[model samples]
Target: MSDLSRTPLYDLHVELGAKMVPFAGYEMPVQYKLGVMKEHLHTRDKAGLFDVSHMGQVIVTGTDYAAAAAALETLIPVNIAGLGENRQRYGLFTTPEGGISDDLMLTNRGDHVFLVVNAACKEADIAHLKTLEPAVTVTPITDRALIALQGPASEEVLAALDPKAADMAFMDVATLTLDGAECWVSRSGYTGEDGYEISVPEAAAEALARKLLAHDAVEPIGLGARDSLRLEAGLCLYGHDIDTETTPAEAALSWAIQTVRRIGGAREGGFPGDETILAQLETGAGKTRVGLRPEGRAPMREGVPLFAAEEGGDPIGQITSGGFGPSVEGPVAMGYLPTELTAEGTTVFGELRGRRVPVTVTALPFVPARFKRKPAKVQQA
Candidate 1:
């Protein structure tokens, strides 16, 4: 752990009695005194603050917004040019063979594009973005810390500091001042709840976190709870559920590719592996990612082999991400399965401890999302 880097809030996390562990080359808190289960449920019911500064933040600039968007479109399969100002979109970097190199979020921040990539893949992703250089200037932002305030109570918690936060809709990005610190905030999060991901200057990060935590509704959540919350929401963890070998189509992420980038659209097929991905869009892939629920109390963890029959058959697929979903109150998992076996309610068997356990294919998001898509109506005085 000595070689691992630490986030700006590392000391605060220690003071809060967090169990620190190594994650993505950083020493991060996995759980606080409340533990994983309580922390997870608290986030779902109230608000939880997460220190996510380990992720990469980069700004892409060009002669103008159009030039930058065009340069970015060449790298990712998303409708960047059509992205509205102060709005963000989820995108993926695809390999020449149509496999996903990484998944990322890009915001159209007026003059330049702001990107947040996975922590473990940031180095590689940054190097990849440099190819768009000359056309677009790639500037990696390092003097900032990222934090996420997530859950049903997140809006009210943040609105207490700045009333303007109440007006922002989901996927909307804005520059707000919290505790006199200039913060870039996005009305989005991984927990499938109404929340905000804020990027603030390193010097002000700790103060902002402390201020947010002072709220009765906000608690310090760690990585352990973060993983479980995302799992219940059926969100993909970069390295586990998606990676270089998995194509967006196979990962059930086709929704991220807007229709404008599809075949026959005005700007169709410009990104890497466009041909392969476009063809998959027309014709489905061999395997598709699906939600799984183990029949018994036990969890069918990641790398567990899946089979078509109860016994005596070779593995059909493997679980990619699995855990006890606190919100769902059951063991939930996600994995790839043959397209034929991907129908809802289809039965599959997972090899667990040398015994085959029954599992069912189900719709994703064990817990329904609670995002605030529209602004709240103001009450008359």
Candidate 2:
């Protein structure tokens, strides 16, 4: 633990009685005194504050939007050039073989592009960005702290601090002043809830977090509940659900690739592994990721071999992520399964402790998402 890095909120986490643990080379809080179950429930019922400063925040600068977008397009299969200002999109960095290097969120910040990648992949991601031909600048914002205020009541809490926060739609980004501190806020989160990710200077993080926590509906949460929330939400965790060996098609994230980057668009097939990815898109992948619900109380876990329920059957795939979902009130998991068995209601078994645990293939997101989208405009004569 001595070699582990600490976030800007480390002291506050300790002061709040957080159980410290090492994750992605950082000393993070896995749970507070409320424990994982209560924390998970609190976020669902109200709002929860999470210190996600360990994640990477980077800015990509170039001479112009066209050059920067094109340079970024060469790395990922997304329509970066088409993204409007202040709007964000989810994307994945792919290898030449079409496997995912890392999953990320990209936002067009008018003058430059803002990228947020997984903590463990930030270094390599930055290095990869620097290698692009257009001579764009990759600037890592290590002096910033990211806090996620997530849950159904997030808007209420944040709007009190900055009224303009309520005006933003889902996946919208803004630079605002919160209690006089510069804050780069985004109306998005990983918990499948309506929330905001607040990026502020490191020195002001604790104060801002305290102000948010002072809200009657807000509580400090930890990584333990964060994991369960994401699992219930069916969001993928980097390195576990996705890695260098998994492609977007195999990861069930083909939706992230827009049509413009596909076969019949104006700009198509210039990204890494475009050939392999395009082929997979056309012909279908061998194995695809699917959600699983264990029939019994036993929780299926990672590396558990999946098999068909027939006698002397060979393993089909393996579980990548699994856990007990507080919101779902059951054991939920996601893993790779053969395309033939990827349909909902399919039967599968996971080997656990020398016994076969029966599970059913189900649609992802055990819990329904509560994202706040912009209301449709009304027209009158």
Top lDDT hit: 1
What is the C-alpha lDDT profile of model 1 across 63-178, one tens digit per residue?
99999999999999999999999998899999998989889999999999999999999999999999998889999999999999999889899988888899999999999999
Which regions of candidate 1 are displaced past 4 Å? 375-381
Q: Rate the local accuracy (lDDT) of all candidates.
A: 0.94, 0.93
Assess candidate 2 and give its TM-score to the true structure: 0.98
User: TM-scores of the models, in the given order?
Assistant: 0.98, 0.98
C-alpha RMSD of each candidate structure in angstroms: 2.9, 1.4
Which residue segments of model 2 deviate by more than 4 Å?
377-381
Cα misplacement distance, residue 175 of candidate 2 (Å)? 1.1
Instruction: For residues 262-296, write the lDDT of model 2, one tens digit per residue.
Output: 98888888999999998898889999999999887
